[model samples]
Target: MVDLYTHILPNVEKGPRDVNAFLTMAKSLVDQGVKNVVASPTYNGQDLEKQNIMLYVEAANKHLQHAFIPLTILPGQKVTIHYRLIQAFEQNVHLPINHSTKYMFLQLPNENTDVLNEQILYELQLKGIVPIINEPERHPTFLEDSDLLYEIVKRGAIVQLSSDSIVGKNGRKEKKAALTFIDKGLAHIIASGVCADTYESYTLPKAYDMVSRQFGTQILYKFMENADYIVEGKAIFKEQPERVKKGKFLGIF
Candidate 1:
């Protein structure tokens, strides 16, 4: 399974202890049996925004060589916001992406609606780049107004929810929002936004199980197809099961 998003700092190589700490954290994810992890650099509140993304990408690749089969680089939002985001579109030039990479991951401001985010996505689409937004539910504004989620999907952005949100690790509200979006068919993928060793948080496989039980096994495939198409630059939803889950269950008498 492909666990989508994580924040592996680039400056971890600053010292021996730092390198060891990062490897230990990364290996823990591998120990949990993840096949591949797509990671982006964090940039919530920092002076060195996008300063360490390149290093993070390099670190992910290095760790993946020994831990997983296919290491995917989720271009941190700092990279997107600072450069490479609207470059070709803004300049009207055709540029080829790095030979090894295909997709870019971005984070939204906690307080903005999907409108500005859509503009960014449209710019990316115009430039022929597929942008995947990370953890939309974590955005305070998005949570306050769920309809924005549907609107974002209406535009060309794929929404990734954290695994912890899926199984109620974040809270009942987060879990409900996540499931509601899934039920409405808005959310496209589940990523393990792992920060540290926390047993209460949902792992990728466990989240998959919970989603399968709540929705269906077929939705899982649809989610994967969404990720694949975005990375592959496809503009259509992959063919899916015609039958959608119906008939809610009630507690036993």
Candidate 2:
């Protein structure tokens, strides 16, 4: 499986402290059935940070080869939201998901998404870049009113739910939001946003089990297929997003 969001790179962002730590994390992911991991360290539009992450990816891949590990680490960045996001992409500072340049893992602020966020997503789409919002379930704004998420998805943005969120690692609110996203067909992919520190509780197998139990196997397959689409830089399959009807919040159960 393709675990699209990870901080497995050594000494980059809040990931593993050293190469040894990164290798351990990679081994754990491989053990959890992850074959392709996108090394998405956080990027705030800094050139130095981007360079450092690339270096870490190169070093990590070399070690994987030496260790004969079957895991393949791909280059990516979890870009923080900013008004000049389109400009960063134009300047080639922002690394897209798997270096595809067509799909990017974008982080939205916890606050309510305003016109500016929509504008950035619109501009990114204009340039052939699809912004996949990372873990919207954890954001307060989304938890407050899920219709906002449907709006974003309607405007050509994809929503990526964290694997841990589905399994209740993030808490009750996030879990509810995640399940709601699946029920409403707003979530396109489920990624193991496993960092170096949180592997035991956030395993991909557990996440899949939780999703299958709650949403069924067909929804699980859609998420897995979407991950492959992202890796291939192709458009993901998105069902028409529907808002949660009043008094139907418990329908997922």
Candidate 3:
């Protein structure tokens, strides 16, 4: 499977600290049956950071070949939804998934506001970039108001749900939200490596098996296909998202 979000690059978020640490983390993903992973460091719109991301991706891929590891690491970032991201894009930085200018992973903080909400996403869409927001299931703002996410999805943003969250590794609230997103057709992709601190390396694979059992293969296959498309830089399949009731379970068991 393809993991669209990971911090396997050193100095990129809390993935790994050094080359050795990176290998160790990558090995964990390999052991979990993940063949490809996108390295998502926390980007802040700097040319130097872009260079470093490219540098680490090349170096890490070489190391994988030299060490006989079969896993491939793709280049990507979990860019914070700052206003400057607009300027950065205008300046020619392709903050996209797997180096593809079509899709990009843009993250919103807990305290999301108007700037982080509709405006930037609309702007990105105007440029033909489909912004993929990671783990809205765990965001306090989104949890408090599920319609917020529906509105964003209606505006053309894709949702990437965290596997561990759906696996109930984060907490009950996160689990409920994660499953609800899938039930409502809001989630377009599933991935791991939200953070090294919450790393239960096996949960991603476990989540797939368990979710496929509980929710059926239709939902499972859609997100899985979307992951592959993101890596390949092609258009992904998105369901017509159904709006969620404020306090109901939304049919998610």
Q: Of the candidates shown, which would achieve the greatest TM-score relative to the real structure?
A: 2
Candidate 2 per-residue lDDT, tens place, 1-253, comes to: 9988887777776688987887887787788788998888776655345556677788889999998888998899888788777777777788887775589888886554588788888888898889999999888877766778888898889999988888887888788878888888889998887876797666577877888888789878888888998988877788889987766653455
lDDT of 2 at 22: 78
Off by over 4 Å in 2: 46-51, 111-113, 247-252
Record all residue pairs in model 1 with backbone atoms less than 3 Å apart, i.e. clashing: none
Candidate 1 lDDT trough over 10 residues, lowest sum = 244-253
Ranking by lDDT: 2, 3, 1
* Residue 122 local lDDT, model 3: 93
Candidate 3 residue-wise lDDT, 1-253, digit = tens: 8888876766566766677777777777788778998888877555346666888899889988887888998888777887777888887665577776588888786567865668889999998999998889878878878888898998899998888898887788898888888888888988886455545555777788867987899878877888898888888898899889856843356
Estimate the TM-score of every prediction.
0.71, 0.93, 0.92
RMSD in order of candidates? 6.0, 1.8, 2.1
Q: Rank by TM-score, descending?
A: 2, 3, 1
Q: Rate residue 74 of model 3 by lDDT.
A: 88
User: What C-alpha lDDT do the candidate models reach, one value each?
Assistant: 0.56, 0.81, 0.80
Q: Indicate the residue-level lDDT of 76 in model 1.
A: 38
